[model samples]
Target: MVAYRSKVVERIELPARERRERALEEAGYNVFELPSEDVYIDLLTDSGTGAMSDAQWAALMRGDESYAGSRSFDELESAVAEVMGFSRVVPTHQGRGAENVLYGALLSDGDVVPNNTHFDTTRAHVANQGADPVDCPVAGARDPTADGEFKGNFSLERAREVVDDVGAERVPLVIQTITNNSAAGQPVSVENTRQVREFADRIDATFVIDACRFAENAAFVRRREDEFADYAIDEIAREQLRHADAVVMSGKKDGLANAGGFVATDDADLFERCKQRAILYEGFPTYGGMSGRDVAAMAVGLREAVEEGYVTDRLEEIQAFADLLEDAGVPVYTPPGGHAVYLDAGAALPHLDAADFPGQALVCELYREGGVRGVELGSFAFPDTDRPELVRLAVPRRTYHGEHFEHVADTAAAVLEKRESVSGLEVVSEPANPELRHFTAALAPLSD
Candidate 1:
């Protein structure tokens, strides 16, 4: 079928190449690309739940009584203990920092770190360390339900298969978490988490919780299962801790605090081993590289994040965004789970295939028409270089007001209208094994 551009266009040739990109920008149009915008409506990820109160921020800035051997460490430790109910906790700069220590210390070059799907950074750390980061394709990994709700649920059988395929001695940690980021915020139910617990016990594999999206998981628990629905946030958090040896938190998202994270566990021996990593990457074990105030803030933030209204508010906004797109006839990730919406760019623009940079093209178009930004997921976030990419839009916790929904909806619909005429994408070569792969956005030029 012949493609067509939006009817509301007036094309003008520009002498300078920069002018061409500038023209799109000057129009105040955009779909936020990663690393570019503050108000990016992102569903692509989350630490867990994010953005602590100003009080928490102030506390973090106050600096705990301990810098290295400070009381801050004790305060922070106590806070970590309160959340996970584990006395043994080590602080890291952030989530990946925690991963570095975990993999650097525990995993040898030949070891395997298995999970449902490791985040981009986690995968990089494992691969860079010369260990195979195995994402045991959950049973339903290949075929996700339309809504993508079940994507986070890993098959115990798949875990078994991977373990059997690669002996347990070679597998260091079985770690994965809530709102499996790569899977459209699909949640792994408590039952599945428990199953993992039993499996870990059977295999003697160390189970690590990437509680990055723990709050969302908790929300799901309350929504999906009745028994959990009534449980208080802190109570539910404590119970979830039963299944894992330790947790790596990204305070940015989960703790609701600013820059700090923790590697925590109740296992005394493993806890001591984890401390060494602190000395190397983080500061002294006492402070674990974070100020006591951050500890205090996170401690307080963690509790506040669990407030019923807060989680509910975030969920409502996400649904509202989803509703906006759905009403516009957009092919959104059905049954949108958490913050942000996944517009099936391939389906939305059948004229442009996902293989030809559908996500990147769509994102560029949105930016050219509306000043909203989002990331690519199926088209970019997904694994398998030769697979569909996702243009992931991550909506931060409480990032938008009601008016913003209209901006997102109208902008998306306008782009979808020009779907047929939008240019397809081609990878102009990316660096091999680079940490951040850069892609230049281009539309197949209007040819003769």
Candidate 2:
């Protein structure tokens, strides 16, 4: 395939290490609190940070700004229908909005929701509703270095056990996140989804999908699943969604849009309920929480994201970065997932124990050493859980080129060279609200 060429039109100057360290200290050692100008390569997340294509920008100008039933909504609805095989599309400002409305409508006190692995926000939303969120990832998923092809697969046996233990009545729904973000962005097999759907049906529970990276997941399915090798990406995506009762999507990731999300379903009753909640919390059913321009960009991005050439190119870019890190002897999660490369902070900084938050430590060191910002996906992000300490470098869609990744790889290598000197961190101040504490938690380097 021929490569598509694009030119850069904007540039920003980054601050020096001393300036960045002062900013980091003022921000209380939270990478999230640092200003963009202070950082060099920002990889905090792929969410809402991708660069829009020329066509997407053009579509934004053609946005139809109507209070209800806007033309842009029509296009978005049509795109969602065609790409996801869903009949309804209730737009939102971002993925969590979709989750908020969907879970709010379905969950009640004592309800239990199971997933392969719940991303931080998803887990928080479920917990907020007085519902228990359980993770039933496949056994291989726990091992970061495992070469399992479908590490994101849900454990069917565990799912059945949960359903039996909690009783079907107490179980509101079973969610499966495509390209499981919390589990190193691993892809779930098409066969796995079918099996989970059957299990959900047997237990009389709803099976919804957290399809933030559906396109990228589809690309993996086409390459990894023998039966799907002959199928187009859109067809593979539709087949995957066919097993789900509904889909909650963050258009920010796969939709290639800067900001937009939606809850899609073919079930008329669920659609109606979600639509009502969307209106109450988000906006009118058509526009939800997004503007007309965002909707238009998302509609175009939804289509562009699933193209065979584009998916291949994007995956290659991500893998190249991961390969670079691995070559430098960094302990990276292998069989690289669709979106991000996860560095094993525990192994990278063996001197720091889990209690010291090695992941958070690595995140700080990367910024202090190279002005590169990344998010910690380990204990700092989930204090109650025993999840491994990891620093995630999520690649934004079409945002950076090969040169940028090379720079990141070099920065990471530089940090590793002085890994022994990198100290651990302890909480200086934590939010009163325990939920999602990593976003606002303050920390300080431990004394030698």
Candidate 3:
């Protein structure tokens, strides 16, 4: 396959084996704390890690640095409206900032927000608002072995169960995360989105979309859903988002920018409330928590993210990464996903239990073996939540090539060969907020 875009000016050199070991020890076995200089392949996250396109870089110069009524804000608002079908836009620093700003306006104490699967930050933001975040991903998502195409789909039955238990009046929001990050970056179907929309309407709750990877999810919908087989990627994206009343998006993901996010809605009342919150927590509504240049770049990225060529290349790259891992006898979550390849840490390290943190152990082993940094999506991330133990190798858009992923596969295979020798991790120190502990938790080998 030909390169869609190519320019590699910066170069990186991996730290020595001893340096990598020392770095791991210094970080207390937490990959998140490891300095980038010591890591070879940094898969810690896709957020703010993607390479910006030339067009986006050029858009930076068009930024209006005004404190209010900036031209850059107009560009972003227009992009959000044209691509996501939202009428109002509230800028934020990042995705969690958007979640915080929007949820503060929408959720009250004891309110329930049902989602396909809430990622770490989303869950934390909801909890911080004194509301409950209930995950209702399809059954297929729970089983790492399942090969379903739309495993990220919100389970209407499960969500209904939550509503039935909590009463519809207590359910204020129904959020659907595109390419559900917590569920192995699986894609949610348009049919599922429609079903969720109907459910939200029946319950008189606002339907929201956590649209970090909206374009990726739409690409999957176009490939898997018969009804959308003929639709363009952008059309599919708009169709999926159309079912939602509002959206909280992290521009870092699908937007292909390093920073920036937005909360968009069609409801005037809700939009006004979110804007108020943004003004209080973030900066002025025009710039929010970002600079004008960042907003402008994000505007360009939002449009580029929906292009069919870019979406196809990204999906293919992730698929190839998953394939490479599987061929190397690494246990992986099936059907692949949009942004990352999830390793079934429990399956790979069957000797360890959930309490032992197999996912964290796999993360540590991968880094120690090859200076590769990935994150645990299991007990460490969710803490007491009964979910699959998986390690996520999130690929940054336009950052790496086939060779990098090939090296990752080889590293994972090496870890698997020594799987039994890999000791489980025990948390030595964690944050007060259990939901956000994974971000800064310190761990140690169980054997120690």
Q: What are the per-residue Cα lDDT tens digits for candidate 1 across 64-136?
A: 6556666656666777677667787788777778878776766778878777766677777888888887665
lDDT of residue 62 for candidate 3: 80
Candidates sorted by TM-score, best first: 3, 2, 1
Which residues of candidate 1, in runs, are more than 4 Å off? Answer: 1-20, 23-51, 137-150, 289-293, 382-388, 434-448
Which candidate achieves the best lDDT against the true structure?
A: 3
Whole-model lDDT, model 2? 0.90
List all candidate RMSDs to the true structure.
7.5, 1.2, 1.0
Write down the lDDT of every candidate, Cα atoms only: 0.66, 0.90, 0.91
lDDT of 2 by residue, 1-448 (tens): 3346666555755678789889989988899999888888899999989889889999999999898989999999999988999988889999999999999888999999999998888998898899999999888786888888899999988878898897989887999999899999999999999998988898788999999999999999998999999999999999999899999999999999999999999889999999999999999998998999999999999999999888998889888999999988888987889999999998999988999999999999888877889999998898888788889999988878777888888888899999999988999999865658999999998997
Candidates in order, TM-scores: namely: 0.84, 0.98, 0.98
| Candidate 2 local lDDT, residue 299 | 97
Which has the higher TM-score value, candidate number 1 or candidate number 3? Answer: 3
Poorest 10 consecutive residues by lDDT, candidate 1: 1-10
What is the lDDT, from 0 to 100, of the residue 349 in candidate 1? Answer: 64
